[model samples]
Target: MDVNLQFWSTEGKSFFQRFLHWADILDPTVLLNSNKKIEKSRLLLQTNAQTLQEPLQDKKVKEAWKLSLSSVHPGTGEIIPLVFRPPAFLPLATPLLFASLLPHRGAKQAIIWQAFPYFVMTQHKLSGPMQTFFKRILPIPLLACLSVFNVMIVRGTEYENGIEVMDKNGKVIGVSQKAGLKAVQETALSRAALFGTAVIIPESLLYFLYRTNFLLRNPHALTPLRLVMTVSALGAMLPVSFSVFPQLGEIKRDDLEKEILSSTEETELFYNRGV
Candidate 1:
């Protein structure tokens, strides 16, 4: 089996095992590795996979797996763009988060909404749904919506290209659009959940922290503190969201569309759920 395929196969692990697996892959340091190193890691895994289940364990092999998996697309075997890669997400979002956290912007929103009643039965100042959306917990869901939209725009071609289904022997059997859409949908939801948690938790934590005397006593700590929280949330959630759905999704032969069904006699097959 392809190492990537093996990683996501049903035999791989339970949720906790998958969580630990992704935690290694999602390490941001993978972004620092050179092209040469990534190829070497791929080679190591390939050479050792048949002989060793753990694959010649050592720091080099381990780090190599991390860099290769995180940097390269499992489906296409291409280097994912820096910004779009999971490890790079925190680095890209952290600074903008800090800027958004400036007191003036939040103060403006709080001031405008402060006077509005929590529950306005009159429905004149603002409609009930509108008020709840803007003032309540819906901001996270809205961000999730945008996450789905972005995924569609950025990687829509994967849906069109269809997934290459493979037999247990690792031979390509056929392409299936059903498998492809499932992968994309799961990825979209995972991304939404990831960013939603990342954004909401830090702000909520800092909102309370802002009132504490510690921040007042040392305003300089705010920058590092914000960085810590954002990175921590991503560290915790990336594994979860990635593991929420299997990266290699399965389709029973009976469930596939008529066109895809005729290509293989096997009762079950697998497709790469691109990261």
Candidate 2:
């Protein structure tokens, strides 16, 4: 069974189970695995006679799965980009906080920086609109749109190549573009939700925290406090955001296009919804 498909599978599983696995997948250590190691793990599973119904009692199989899943791409069979991998997302993004939050050195940079947080308000700020009103909002609708556009540009071929769809027994059926689009859409939504919750919540919380008695008295504490809030928010929201949709999404035979439906009589087909 492809690990991503297994994760996306909703059959008899609850949200909590998926969330826990997602947490493991997002662990930073997985980013350290080499291509050789991932191939070894995949080969181990392939040689197992019972791979069709895996998660065997052998603890090695389970560990191998985590490594393979974290490093290898489900549809493409290629190593995920170092910075873009799920586990590396937080680690890589953390350093960016300094640049994002701290004051910039030049006028042009300051203009762009100020526009990002309360972008809607920045344009109107010149017209004397209230800062309080604008500070409370983010351009999330625009962010989500851009996020989707990015996936379309970066991995447009995946939709045409199609994501693998499977049956209940972990057997491969066929690939379909319809299923691929759903997976890509869900993944994009999750990415947006992740950033939105991570950014908006911490900023909101810290905005109030800065006014509190303790923070007001110790101004130096706010910098570390904001970093901690960002990490906490990102770590906590990563799994929850991805779990918004099943990793393995279902498309009914009736709903599928004739290309796939004509081959399989199975009413429920599963596709690996991209992470």
- In model 2, the worst 10-residue window by lDDT is 133-142
Model 1, 30-135: lDDT tens per residue? 7887778777878777787542356325776667667766777776677777788878866786665445433332333432222233334224557667764545
Q: Compared with the true structure, what per-residue lDDT tens digits does model 2 show for residues 1-275?
A: 66545534532166787788778878998888787888888888667756436564578887777876677777666777877787887788666643455544444674343455555445555333365444444343444555567667676775877777877877778878888877787788787777667767667787787677778888898788778887898889988986678766777878767887777889898876766
TM-score for each model: 0.77, 0.81
Q: Can you tell me which runs of candidate 2 are displaced by over 4 Å? A: 1-12, 50-56, 101-107, 110-129, 139-145, 160-162, 169-175
Q: Per-residue error at 29 for model 2, in Å? A: 1.5
Clash pairs, model 1 backbone: none
Q: What C-alpha lDDT values do all the predictions have?
A: 0.70, 0.70
The TM-score between candidate 1 and the true structure equals 0.77
After superposition on all C-alphas, the RMSD of every candidate to the true structure, in Å, is 5.3, 3.5
Q: What is residue 164's positional error in candidate 2, in angstroms?
A: 4.0
Error of 2 at 5 (Å): 3.2
